[model samples]
Target: MAASSIANPRSDTANQVWTDLSPLLQFNNMEIINVADGVTSFLIHPEITTTVGRLKHCTFMAVLWEIWCSRNRARFQGQDMSAKHIINRSMLSIRAITIAANFQKILQPWLVALCQSNSRNEILKVLIPKVVRWLTPPPGRLKMNVDGAFNMTSGEAGGGGILRDHKGNMCCAFAKPYHGLNSSLSTEALALRDDLSICCSKGVYEVLLETDSLNLLHIATR
Candidate 1:
């Protein structure tokens, strides 16, 4: 087995892509001893605490992971790998990680530009994050806040809710796992049903229901 398919891809298409992406990779196309050295050189100069450094680290790691997956597919499954595919797959991971890291404000423009042009040097405008605050319910009424999540890939669904008093103190909370749920809307409906059942059992009639889903809220109010 070779040291790394990413460092020295066998295919001409991959080689050309590596050349094109070398500018973004920074330390690429250099005479490095091994994969570790190449990665170390890529990360050594910049402090990972900085925005550009974080983006570089994520891109480098995602590229490496995609490259390894490509190598496995080519070697074990007798599949042909395309550098474009690797770039696309790696970008998905990079984008997700970037969002999770809260680097969207700083790094999103670069990612968008990278798709159009492989340039990573420009810093675009800053995006302010939206602020959300919870409001208290009327006096002597309990507020029920609920949320549900459905996984498109795994076919898993789950929901949870918390009941709070007018003072914003948690009274009760419940969570349940669901399988074979078709859509998130259905899950939200079921959560509402479960929460209402809990309230009914407790003889609580004056309840205010709160949910982040506008569709669910409209249907519920109607």
Candidate 2:
């Protein structure tokens, strides 16, 4: 409940914040609990005083603070911030704190490297790559992109596909919700089958099928 006070009045805000931060600040299964529970557990553990543990603990606090501040800014000043922006700001703040206190001993090698970079432009250049344009299908051929997602906790899977012409105009799109999927491979296979069936039904003989699953690709080609 580290930032519970800030989110008490807005349940939706709390959900959004959690959704954005969960992937960035994952904890071990035993350490996964309410924010207050996790914080208390960390405090009680002797290892929490170690250099690495202390750095991680401080990082968690900084990220929580950044999330609260970003929420307030969005609510009052009409300025919204992305999760990436919050993380970047938190890192910079931690770097500043480490510098002021001369806490280099506790800093990780990666953190030391980040601090040494100093230049925002250099960091950006290293972190963000140039965008590339999507390739268009050859003339007379339709392009189909299919993907699938599996939720381990829910034991459910979903798949979707989109078909576009050579000019990149969308011709058709489809999505399906599946339950009790054994694995991601099954979901992906189902998606490919459905997408290809749709194209066949539409009289599309020539197609450029694209999928991220190497297994599926190999299966189809073979």
Candidate 3:
């Protein structure tokens, strides 16, 4: 398999990927002569036959897929992103999978214990409160908050905004549907423009604008 990977220029540069990954695999006690051998070892292990093991095995496969994709991009698109980038991406993917597995392991037992207790007071004690405080505008200024949502299946998007006074009273609210937007950035920009236009129509010059999108805020401020 390693020879085939090295010989076939169209194949996934797996030999290089394996070379970069070998140390980590050895550290995990999964050292092998080749990728196929490593997979065979995983299949034969009893722990790997369990549900969580299967997920880990799948994550390993996904790493290989990502490596192949990166190699193809470098070969075809002339985007020679380094092997270290591929390794970093794989590590992040595996870390996310591990975190999800640990979260599920803890959540199942927590849910069971919660059900067994069935006391409102016990539940309230375990729950943590999250509070969000909205800032108010100065005396003469009107605050406008804008947001956007997209529907992937329908290829449609919508944007809305609310104008509020210093005392947090809503002066006006507007929503508009959009079509054929390629990305969330476009929708956010459109939302901001729509809110600005509404404010202009309402003759409110002193304005404070807010949005949850960091990209939009950066662009607007710049």
Candidate 4:
């Protein structure tokens, strides 16, 4: 115990040793390269720290703490667990959770879907709104409605919007072109700005712009 303590004492060296070992928990694509000897965090900014740390901690914790749940799932149940059935393992897990979380369980279907998706980016085109609606949802407002679209194959982007008055009557329905590949954020911004711009043109002020994208709300406010 004394020799082990001397060799692996709880110092910066020990911390870094932990860091190196924990990264094995990560998917190979998610690992950070080019970390210098003194660099403690990527981006070196406090804002990015929480983002990076949360991701690393969650993935690390998931793999380290829960591998038993995912590893050779059927063997513990006394079944034939082998190579041919291995890849389908996570899918079986996700399909079960997809029904339970009603698809709100973020990791399961998402990672499985990404691996199975046609373009991955294209799947996000269909997925982002569903996820947004589930997460930072806003009730439909009678005063404003927002819609957005992005097509990965053709790279075509478009948006439509509508605004109604207090009586729940339609005042206008609007549409416009979008140009960019900033993914969901790009289309989200255009949709909100389109409604705001229309309100500005008509000298109308103070509107409830209904949108599902919380990131866009933060971006638009800034």
Error of 3 at 126 (Å): 12
Query: What is the Cα-based lDDT of residue 159 in candidate 1?
Result: 90
Better of 3 and 4 by TM-score: 3
Residue-level lDDT of model 2, residues 1-222, one tens digit each, is 344343222445444544454443344322344655654554455355565556556666776688788877787768766666776776776666555554545433545433444433344333332333578898988899999988675587999999998899999999999887888888999999999899989988788989989988898889
lDDT of each: 0.73, 0.67, 0.64, 0.48
Candidate 4 weakest ten by summed lDDT: 128-137
> What are the per-residue Cα lDDT tens digits for candidate 4 across 1-222?
222222223344323433443332233212435333112342132332343333333333333222333233444545443322332343344334333444332443344432434332344332221222222223443467787778676677888887777666677878988886547678867887788888878766867777767887787679
TM-score of 3: 0.43
Residue 42 alpha-carbon offset, candidate 4, angstroms: 64
lDDT (tens digit, per residue) of candidate 1 on 7-51 = 565567556556656666665544565765665566687778877
Q: Could you say which candidate leads in TM-score?
A: 2
Position 85, candidate 1: lDDT:
88
lDDT for model 4 comes to 0.48
| Candidate 3 lDDT tens digits, 113-158 | 2232233235333333233479999997889999998767556899
Instruction: Give the TM-score (vs. native) of candidate 1.
Output: 0.46
* Backbone clash count, each prediction separately: 0, 1, 0, 0
In model 4, pairs of residues that clash are none
**Which model is ahead, 2 or 3, in terms of TM-score?**
2
lDDT winner between candidates 3 and 4: 3
